[model samples]
Target: MVSFTASAQYGKQKKADTLFNKFSFVKAAEVYKELIENKYNEDYAVRRLADCYALLRDVKNAAKYYKKAVKQDNVPIEYYYNYAQALRGVEDYKGSREWMRRYKDSGGVTSTKNFGKDGNFITSIFNAKQQYFLSKVNFNSKLSDFGAYEHNGKVYFASTRDEGVSVKRLYGWNEQPFLDVYVTEKGSKDPVDHKAKLKGDVNSIYHDGPVAITKDGTTMYFTRNDFFKNVQEKDKKGINNIKIYRATLKDSVWTDVEDLPINNSEYTTQHPALSSDGKKLYFASDRPGGFGGSDIYAVDINEDGSLGTPENLGDVINTPGAEGMPFINNEGTLFFSSDGHVGLGMLDIFATVADKDNKIIDVINLGVPVNSSKDDFSFFMGEDGLTGYIASNRSGGMGDDDIYAYNRVPLLNVEGVVTDAINKKPIANAIITLLDGNNRQIAYMETDEEGYYEINIDRDVDYNITASQKKYEDDSESFTTKNIETKVTTITKNLELNPVQDVVILAELNTIYFDFDKHNIRPDAALELDKIVNLMLNEYPGMVIRIESHTDSRGDLTYNDKLSIDRANSTYEYLISKGIDPARITEHQGFGERRLTNGCDGSVNCEESNHQLNRRTEFIVIKMK
Candidate 1:
């Protein structure tokens, strides 16, 4: 009947602090708000309440509290960090950057992490063919929802939905209805809206979800409250921790549920991601000795359906920030979300490929469409790879966290190493050229120190990759990227550039064509000649190039000889003008109609390509002084 604040009951302030310490943030916010309204410990109350909102990922409310507390003294540097993250989510770039600057100035935090890498990674990701963008789920509710995994044609995930049952009520953590695992009905009009089955045994009146279903659909690995098995464990802060659990479906109902061996009540272990074969289990934990708040870990599944010891994914995949929601694709590539690595803001999704030895390899941030300034996590890719699902709290979402369908248009990871064919060692600094099926230049990059080069390619396209070095023979490979069933995404274009032999062909230019009955160099012909000029003047200065020009057998032999001579002289003069010494050209001879490459020597009806092949010029190393 009356308004009461902490000033009216200062004795309860310690109780509020205790509740906050227990990570019961929603309830703590209420107490802190009361204290602030009554002018009791207003500064700390406003700041602490704001921290709770930020931790809960309520960006707008966090921003509100930050605006009030930013001017206060003795505020933690993370407050500035949270302020920046929250500002960016609300489209306040200038404010966010300024707050980022303050966070840097006020004892800037650095933990062996590349803070700007994620933002830069986004650039290249978008520059490559765009493939992943969020599509709002049709059945997203106004409550928190996330972590959708597809199994048996239905998607199983976690959600906070209302069921109008009192005993199945609120969780003090977010003040939402107890989180439960839900699944979409494959035959339903809208699967996301379908009530999930196997709830009672597998789910508790506490948080449950983001499950990993085995290939057989008989076993499940999921996360739920630690109290599910009467093991009510809490951290030093008194907040109940989460544990990973495994269960089996008996008679179409999940009957047996048990916690994994690696789960600890003292910290937290949640977000289960399993390999497609169910042999590898990846999850997030906040246990000590981690790089930061939470780190991604992996455990091998034994042949007997038990877990191996947990292994940290190391510094590459796990940073000093939170990393969760690991999803391993069909090819064993690991996809997870991290806040430790520098990203657009908050948590961003990243991927790491697995080597043949089944060890995790290079981690890459999946920039732009999959990541935003707002928190984006809970990524699941279907077997087809063309479509998947991700969970995010970015702007324009249906709820606190909504599941969005991600459709990848056509993208693939193309990688290879340039090695000397003779030595079998990686070639460093080899120039690599990428061309599409139409022979149009796509992109170029040099090999790294280890002779490794990787690039993103649009799928369903035939690509030609040419690798060249000054002293090595140019090598090229034709790559056809088939979408959907593209397990060969990481194409090993392991090019072997053999050293030039005595009779060297420096530039293997494709059919250098001339215009009909013409001797002058066309644009395509000039481009090819330029490459020869470069080889002669810049690369092979000591070699003498004999430019031999030929024409189709369509004209008189004498006239053809004269026209071919003109063509040879035109190419020679162009090379000379481009700084290739006249001495380098030992001879510019015209072969006329005598050297027709094919039987289409005016004796048979042939297509233009055959005729063009005959109307060609080539440079050969005749003498190497």
Candidate 2:
């Protein structure tokens, strides 16, 4: 019975590892979780489960499981590095730093390719400048909708929505219907109502679509499974690898389909993109002799319609991880999605910066809203360059992968001043944070000497801003830019922070009094004075105060003046004896028979309780650093 149980466990583990190697993380994670639930090799299952979550960019769950994996015996040192990165993604900087130190101590080789210089890199990236505004397209359904392309006067994309087929077909990877090419008019009043499957022989029973077209719309290149002529071809493992195919349009119907020369039966070559002049074709492939799992390659389109040999984009454009979904804009810039770059999520979209000789110079991440903590790919830009679309599987989407429209507009300058509520004085060195509608931090900075901050933000967004400083209550406010309409708009949002009251006032202490003309610290008076000493010594060590004593109207003016001075000295000495710094008491003085709280002057008869209020000592707060 025990031998049979071990065999069953081995079978499940083999299946999960196979899926993971094939880059099907969503399906692999399900099997790994089931193994963990059944207690089948729980330690190995825990490590793989953590890795799956990390690859999925689900940092919250990844961190949770990694915390458990690191506590297990004989764990790999690489898991230490991954756990630190996952913690950093979830904004746990302190924990991440500690685990990173442990990873280094355990002889793990460190590299900053994925995580930059230090632990502070996450904050630096999160506070990047806003360059685009993203909103979900209205036509997205509760299925896999992505790979949006625009040509002529319509938009085409790949989707798994129902198409009324007599028999429902589903893909084993995600349990969704096979992808099909769909189209809708660009400026339709109701795009969902006008949506329909493309009119052509392009789509197949298997996966199809996400096509690229030429300037004259005479040619189209699309991705499809390794199936043609009603027969599917598979690799040795029985997996149908995707391939890029070229189709020509004749009389408004797509026909004459032929596979590209770059495709191989043993590997996958998909995601076709065309240059503006139609003289070059770019695509992603997992062919041999590449830098990573898949690399971006380009081929020359000769005048006679023959293709040249494929050339890899080089190591600078690829990493040990996957890089796919190539898109070239009208200005000859290449945009691609990658998982091996220093980014905010698993798959982030990046743009290439090429030199004068057309050699790639740099790769810049297309920062937030466009690249989220999930798989974001298939970036397409219109000819105007100001409008584009991106697909993401991040939270708050209507489908597995939803399309989001993006617009590039001039940045809005948001300037603000932070001041004290009581004195209206500018508060320098105050921390300011700007957050999006979901309370995710967008930018952060410290106030300048003038208590001023200026941040450039995207238009048509709601922000929650806050200011904080030592010994002051935090101030927060919300602002929106939906009403703004201009090339350059400056929003002035001022904040007022209230100072925390002194410890004595907050403690609500009773009056500290002495015997008539004795000028000695009484037992009752010492108890109240101890409260001030404890607060200053332990809580507010930087507190600076001044001591003042006042006398009643019953004594002679000259003697009462002498008595009040002694009383102030006694209170100051008592606080110093209790371990409070003597320098904290800025000054000690007395005013005799003056500044009475009640109308108990020499001419008026007053009760003893009224006069008691006059003979009191006061602790006035001068500064709290």
**Cα lDDT listed for each candidate:** 0.78, 0.82
lDDT of each residue in 1-625, candidate 2, tens digit only: 9999889988999999998776577788899998998899888988888888887667788988899999999998878877876775675767777887798789875434544545554566678777779987877888888899999988889988865555768876666788988888886656452137777778888999789999999999999999887789988887799999888999888888887788888999999999999999999999999877789999999998889999999877887668999999988999999866666666789999899998887788887878876688999999877788899988899967899988876468789899877456688899999998989998899899999999887778899899998768889999998778654568888998876665655454455887766778888899899888876765555567889998999989988888889889888888888887778798989888887888998789998888878888888877642
Minimal lDDT window, size 10, model 2: 109-118
Clashes of each: 0, 0
Runs in model 2 with CA error above 4 Å? Answer: 11-31, 50-63, 70-121, 189-195, 410-625
What value does the lDDT take at residue 388 in candidate 1? 85
Candidate 1 residue lDDT tens string, 1-625: 2345434557556767887777678888888888887788788888888888877877788889988888888877877877776776665656776786678778877433365442344456557556676677775788888888887788787888754444557776777887788877643565443255445488776778879988988888989888756556776766788999988888878858987899887988999988878889999999888888899899999999878899998987887568888888987888899876656657788888668897766677677778877888888888887688888888798768888888776556678888877446587899999999999988899999999999887777899999998777899989787554644446667898876653445534344678769988899888888777766655555556688898988889999999889888888888889987787678998999888888987767999878888888877676542
Pairs that collide in candidate 2 are: none
TM-score of each: 0.68, 0.61
Judged by lDDT against the true structure, how good is candidate 2?
0.82
